[model samples]
Target: MKIIKDDLAGTEIKALLQEHLDDMYATSPPESVHALDVDALRRPEITFWSAWLESDLVGCIALKSLEPGHGEIKSMRTANIARGKGVAKTLLQHLVEQARSSGLHKLSLETGTQAFFAPARNLYLGYGFKECAPFSDYRLDPNSVFMTKCIKE
Candidate 1:
């Protein structure tokens, strides 16, 4: 599988993002859902990528610049059929490498604190992310958990 920067205009990607949003809403309260939609991910500050296995889209992730050397992870999701296949691992590694190359010193993300988000939380923890207080414009929320990692440049 290969990771490619995406334009967020393809039907497949849109569907995937919608599925991601739906799952987020299903798992967390509306006030706690931070997953961005297609239009939000298309903004200039966000760089979105899609993981493809041949012609199939397996997973996706985005990096949104928060400051000169900091970024926030957004819209991470793997296709249902692609779970347990290391699709998210590969995509995350790609984003980490891309962040390092782009001079980003930190990467942070917010996810649900519910049981439905256990796998995702574990994935980030396994990737070296540590739990942290809310960053940027985020405030404390019972339904949300924040994680961050500092990249070595």
Candidate 2:
């Protein structure tokens, strides 16, 4: 599979993002949903990427620069059919490498504390991300779990 930077304008990618948003809303309360829409992902601070297997879009992920040496993981999703195929894992590894190469000293993310997000929290934990206080514009919320990993300089 090939992962490339995306413009967030393609029909397939748009549809996939919409699906991701839907899932987020379905799983979390409106106030707790932090997943950005397409327009937000297109901002200069965010670098979006899609994983493609030939012509099919397999998954997508984004890295958002939070500061000079910090980044956040956003919009990580694998197509329904692509789940269990390591698409998310591969994309995450790719993002980590990209962040390190870009001179980022750390990477962080916010995910739900609900059962629906358990798998995601586990995935982050497996990658050495530790629970942390909210960073950036985030405020403390019982439904939210913040995680961060320090990258070797």
Candidate 3:
């Protein structure tokens, strides 16, 4: 598998993101949804990457620099066909590595508190993320689960 910088214009990637967004909306209440739409994902602060197995897109992840020493994980998704194949893990590892290399002292993410997000929350915990109070522009919300991991410099 190879992870490379995504230009956010690839047709396959665009569709894949749409699917993830739809899935999030399907499983989450409107007020609880924190996943960004395509327009928000294309913002200047976000760096996106797509993981591929030859010609097939397996998954994608993004990193948003929120402030000095801080970064946020955004838009992490594994294609339906690629689930359980380690695609999401690989993409996440890549994002964490990038965050460390970029001098970010901590990486944080906001996910759902519902069962729909258990797998994702577990994955983040496995990678050393710990539950934390909301950061960035986020405020306390029962629907939101915030996590943070300190990246060694």
Candidate 4:
């Protein structure tokens, strides 16, 4: 798979992001949904990347610079056709590597607390992210689960 920095321009990626938002809303209440849409992902502080398996858009992920040496994960999604193909894992690894190389000392994310998000929680946990209290502008919300990792390398 090839992972490339993105600009939220391709129809395939836009469709993937829309599907991601749709699932977030379906799994969590409106107030609990923190997933960003295409426009939000295009913010200057967010560095987005999309993965391709040959000609197929397989997955995407982003790292939003929250402050010096800190970043928050955003828009992590694998296309339906790419599930179970290690696409999410690859995208995550790429993002983490980039963050570390770019001098980010920490990485964090907020995900749903429902059963629908079990796989994602497990993925983050396996990658050394530990559950933490809300960070940044996030406040206490039972519907949200926050995980963080120290990546100073």
Candidate 5:
């Protein structure tokens, strides 16, 4: 799969982001859903990317710069059809490489605590992220679990 920086203007990516948001709201409480929408992913601080197998969209992820040496993972999702493939893994590796290249020393993300999020939690854990306290603008919430990793240079 080819992963490239996306402008977030394609209809396919828009649908994928909507699916991600829909799942976030469906699986977590309204106030606990932290997934960003399409418009939110376009912010200057966030760098978005889309994974594609030829013309079909495989998945997407974004890195949101939080500070001089930190970034928050945002809008990570694999297409329903691409589930079971290594799309998320590839996208994650891509994000980590980009973050490092951008001079970031740490990466963090917030995901739900529900059983529905087990797979996601496992994926992050396998990728070397460890549970941590809320960072950035986040606050402690029972429904949310935060993970962070130090990618020191």
Candidate 6:
């Protein structure tokens, strides 16, 4: 799979993001859902990427710069058809390498506390992220599970 910086203009990617939004809403309450839609993912603060396998979209992930030396992982999703194929893992490792190259000292993310999010939580933990208090603009919320990892330079 090839992971490249996405320009947010592909019809395939747009459809994939729509599917991602639909799934998030299906699994999360309206008030507790924090997944970003296509428009939100286009923000200048966020650097987005889409994984592709011979023109088919497999997954996507983003890094949102929060402050000097800090970044937040966002919009991570694997295509339903591509699940269990290491797409998320590859995208995550790509983001981690990008963070290191960008001089970031920490990486953080906020995911749901529901069972639907277990795979994601486990994936992050396997990468060395540990549960942490809310950071950036986030506040305590039972629906939210925050995790962070210090980048070992």
Residues 76-135 of candidate 4 have per-residue lDDT tens digits of 999999889899899999999999999999999999999989999999999999999999
In model 2, the Cα lDDT at residue 104 comes to 96
Error of 6 at 101 (Å): 0.4
* TM-score, every prediction: 0.98, 0.98, 0.96, 0.98, 0.98, 0.97
Off by over 4 Å in 3: none
lDDT of 6 by residue, 1-153 (tens): 999999999998898888888988998888877888888999998999999899789999999999999999999999988999999999999999999999999999999999999999999999999999999988888989999999857
- Model 4, position 23, has a per-residue lDDT of 97
Each prediction's RMSD to truth: 0.7, 0.8, 0.9, 0.6, 0.7, 0.9
Superior candidate under TM-score, 1 versus 3: 1
Give per-residue lDDT, candidate 2, residue 53. Answer: 92
Summed backbone clashes in each candidate are 0, 0, 0, 0, 0, 0
Question: What C-alpha lDDT does candidate 6 achieve relative to the native structure?
Answer: 0.93
Candidate 1, residues 21-96, lDDT tens digits: the string is 9998888888888999888888999999999999999999999999799999999999998999999999899999
- How high is the CA lDDT of each candidate model? 0.93, 0.96, 0.92, 0.94, 0.94, 0.93
| Global CA lDDT computed for model 5 | 0.94
lDDT for model 1 comes to 0.93
Q: Residue-wise lDDT of candidate 2 within 1-153, one digit each (tens)? A: 999999998999999999999999999889999999999999999999999999999999999999899999999999998888999899999999999999998999999999989989999999999999999999999989999999875
Model 4 bad stretches (over 4 Å)? none
In terms of lDDT, which candidate is strongest?
2
Q: On a 0 to 100 scale, what is the lDDT of residue 127 in model 2?
A: 94
lDDT, candidate 4, residue 125?
97
The CA lDDT at 75 in model 3 is 94
Number of residue pairs clashing in candidate 6, backbone atoms closer than 3 angstroms, sequence gap of 3 or more or interchain: 0
TM-score of 1: 0.98
